[model samples]
Target: MSSSTQHLLVATAALGAVAWLVGVAVITIGIARARNAGDPDATVARARRMRTVTLALTVPGAILVAAAGGWYVLGRDLSIDPNWWIGTALATWLVTTFGSTFGRARQLSLAADRAGEHGTDDEDAQWRIRRVDLIARGELLLLVVAVVVVVLQPTAPL
Candidate 1:
């Protein structure tokens, strides 16, 4: 790719990454706030939209990022330090990807709890949803760690 093309790809990837982060943070916070207010229906609604967010933002962002990485590495010789950071970020991404699976399960559980009569008043359901939120929190942490690894590009000291 030309220099300008590479720069454009990098810029686009950065934008997508930021957009994905913002969406995740907003959705996660919205779900947590609804759960805290004892509003099961609102919690379920927020959790349900997570699939849309993941499909629209997270998945595309990940693909664009990987494409940018592949393009950047096309004719370059990367040293251990660069590879180390990429490896670290990829490791976090792998964990985040797996964690998102459980996160989806939690969302389903929350929706199931509110299936018919609005399980807001059911302490058991509320507790279960809260536990589900814990998974969301962990997934969010993994994403943040991946971003940090990529941004900071930490490497071992000689």
Candidate 2:
């Protein structure tokens, strides 16, 4: 790849990473608000909004990662064999984007329904929120690992 193309790819990946991190922060804040709020409906609403934003950020980030990986393999004249880190990063992003985001969104939707039908303090709503929160924590951890791996770009034999 030309140096300019490589630099552009790097800049795109960096911007995506920053956006992902900001999404994570938003999610964390939403989770905290949900935990502290006395009104379950409000909590569910906040969570739903936050999850939507998180998914929005995730899509572009995943695209950027995939683009960078493609560039490394095709434009950089590098063998795919040495790009395991990119693969790992992409896999983690897939998990976070599809698995965690969709899963949590479903749970939050259920919680919202329960809150509307039953009550703000409904047991079902609370249970669903707890499950979504657990998933969010796992997603955050996976995101951290993905970011570290991408930044390091380990090229050692696997």
Candidate 3:
């Protein structure tokens, strides 16, 4: 592969990994804040939801890793092997961190839901929204990196 293409792949993988790490940190902070909030049920619910999302990411991530590995074996001259592994690790982290957050988020949501027939505290709603926003940001970053990898594919499109 040309040096430029190889660089793109590596950079994409690195960016993906960094984004995932940042997501994990943000979610963790959310969990801590949830724990501090006086609502155990809400925390549990959030944690569960995050867990589901994390698990869902694994299937696609594993496939991507396999594809990257296959590309490497084809003598494409792209060090996608390392990049693939990094991507896989990032996915794994997403699963683990989000899994931890899932239970808590679910709990929080439930509690908030029950707190009132018509509304909930603005703070609680905002907290959950922020956590989801953080996760979404991470996902967007990962997607951008994946697009970069696709664009850098060595094979010419017919």
* Model number with the top lDDT: 2
- lDDT-wise, the better of 1 and 2 is 2
Off by over 4 Å in 1: 79-82, 101-132, 155-158
| Tens digit of per-residue lDDT, candidate 1, span 44-142 | 665667656666676666566666755555534455454687776656656665566325544545555564355555656565656656765776787
lDDT of each: 0.64, 0.72, 0.48
The runs of at least 3 residues in candidate 2 whose Cα sits more than 4 Å from the true structure, single-residue gaps closed, are: 156-158
Query: What is the C-alpha lDDT profile of model 3 across 16-91, one tens digit per residue?
Result: 4444444444455655576568575555455455444443443334344444434433446434354464354445
Score every model by TM-score: 0.73, 0.78, 0.38
Off by over 4 Å in 3: 52-158
Model 1, CA-based lDDT: 0.64
Angstrom error at residue 57, model 3: 7.2
Residue-by-residue lDDT tens digits, candidate 2, 1-158: 68888888878877777776666667766876777877777777786786687568755665675676566557766554667876787678778777775455566677877878998678888777777777777877888888888778788454
Clashes of 3: 24
RMSD of 2: 3.1
